[model samples]
Target: MALFDRYLAGQLLVYFGFFSLVLVAVYWVNRAISLFDSLIAGGSSVITFLEFTALALPNVIYAVLPVSALVATLYGINRLSSDSEMVVAQTTGLSPWRLARPVLAFGLVVALMVSVLGHVLVPLSRTALAERGAELSRDVTARFLKEGEFLHPGRGVTVYVREITPQGELLGLFLQDRRNAAMRTSYTAERAILVRVDGTTRLVMFDGMAQTLQVEDRSLVTTTFQDFAYDLAGLAGGDDGARRRDPREMPTPALLRADAETQAVTRKDVAKLRSEGNVRFSEALFALGLPLLALGFLMLGGYSRFGLWRQILGAVVAAILLKMLANVTETAARDDAALWWTVYIPAILTLALGFALVWRDTRGPHLIRPRGDGAPA
Candidate 1:
């Protein structure tokens, strides 16, 4: 029994690894294209792009593990059945439940890996990635300054620099601010400097003139000054202190023990945080249910020369339905904390279905009514 279990586990792991690698690569590449474009356009280095993509991998891995477990289990079971290994084991007095032990073990292994990613790695990666993005957006000197070209850093704001010195100086600077509908301002400075003050960026223009146009009255005002300051806090969507933290970036422990203060800065409310915390555990638990579900689907077919192709298709459909149910439950849970238990509905249904199938198989072949007038005379 131990040897057979080892063999089954070995087969499942091989398929699981293969499917996970392929899925992650496909997902990563699709995501990396967008990241590469955004980072490069923002004047970030290739190393920064690589780091951002790497940080995104944990979330992708977490998303793929349950599906990978389902595919690997289905493949392993179909291989054994096609090769008649399952039939030999069944005839030798091995029950359906006994055959499923190895599959259950495989499921548990996948569950552990997903748990680590969901509870730890994913949150850390997302937080780091967000911080990096915010930093890139705030890097005005590198991201916004280009000699002899007009740059629009944010909506309704355009800047043009005649030259950028190696000493980090901006010369022949032109700025236009139209963010305030009532007041339009323009500035032309011989030189300008970027400074950070009180966690916000300010453009300090030296020896410049400020021309203000009042849109309501069509009045124009001009002022001459040696120094002028323009607030840039809104340019990058806000500074680190002003940026709200996404719920996905919060640690599991924080979510579980979240207070009103903590919820204030997140995108969602307290109920949403609680629901998200429970979802992490539910997702991990669902991983342990998939293999059992797939094994049950395979066991129902016995050993047919015509093949268990129908059962395989049914298994795929079952997995899809389970995923849809999970998504619906998650959304409902987010809206109502009382519905948080819905997070476990899919897992419970899967386990129950698997158990029922195994019990039916243990009772021997099922009898069916004859069709097409070949009824039992």
Candidate 2:
């Protein structure tokens, strides 16, 4: 019986890995293309794109685990039944409770994996991604150092560089700023340099002349200077890192704190941060219950040549409905942190219903008699 439990557990784990790989590959392709476009469009290198995508993978894998667990459970149950293994095991007088032990153990293992991701890898990766993005935003050389082409960093700004030397010097720089409707300004410089000051980007032009025209009064003013600083903070490709820290990117411990410091740093309310924190723990429950539910629903039916197609479809629907319930509960919790316990309702309900299904199917005339003079007990 111990060997039997090992076999079932091993088979499910193997299939879970297989399905997770396949699904992740499919998801990766789709995400990679979009991310590639976004990074490249932002003037990032191929290496940068790969790094960003890799950092994004933890979130993807976290979302995939639950679905993988469900598919693995249904497929394992179907295979065991189709191959007559389930029949053999039942004929040996194994109670449903006995069979459920291994399934429950496997579910707990899967749940632990989910908890690790939710608590550890996800927050770490998200923080790294955000930090990298902030660095990219301040990297003005990479963003606008393209020579011999006119570039528009914003609606009313135009930049042109004749050449970019190996020493990071920009020659023959031309900049036009017409953002103010009443006036237009043009700058021509012999050279320009990119500088960073307190997480803000600035372009300092050397030996340049500024021409300003007043649109309403048709007046012009000109100024020549040795060096001038132009702020590039709110322009295109700006850093959102300076904006505010997102509660999602914060560690679960910080979010769980929901203190004044955390709230100030994230610029979010206590309810929102607490909800995010609680959701992380609640995800484990879904991971543990979904597989059990899938197995129990499929086990409700006896063997047939046609297979358990109906039971399979029913399990899929149940999973979807449970997911919807989870969403509803999440929304309610988000509105008020006091309702944090609502997040567990879907999982608890799933586990209870799953037990009921498995117990009902393993009872009555369909089940074979046990070996030890068990008076139909």
The lDDT per prediction is 0.84, 0.85
Question: Where is model 1 more than 4 Å wrong at Cα?
Answer: 145-162, 172-190, 205-228, 240-243, 265-267, 365-377
lDDT of 2: 0.85
In the range 1-377, model 1's lDDT, one tens digit per residue, is 88889999999999999999999999999999998876765556789889899889999999999999999999988998888888787888888888989988999999999989998999899989888877777877676567887777667888889998887678999999999999999999999888889978888999989999999999999999898888887886676465788888888878877687668879577678988998998888889988998988777733456777777888889889988999999999889878878988988888888878778777755422223444443
lDDT of 2 by residue, 107-215 (tens): 9998999899999989888889888887776666677788887776566777899999998899999999998999999999999999888877899999999999999
Question: What TM-score against the true fold does each predicted structure earn?
Answer: 0.85, 0.83
**Deviation from native of the Cα of residue 349 in model 2, angstroms:** 1.1
Which residue pairs collide in model 2, if any?
Answer: none
Off by over 4 Å in 2: 148-162, 172-191, 197-199, 205-228, 236-243, 364-377
Cα RMSD to the true fold for all candidates: 3.7, 5.9
Each candidate structure's count of clashing pairs? 0, 0
- Could you tell me the TM-score of candidate 2? 0.83
Clashes of 2: 0
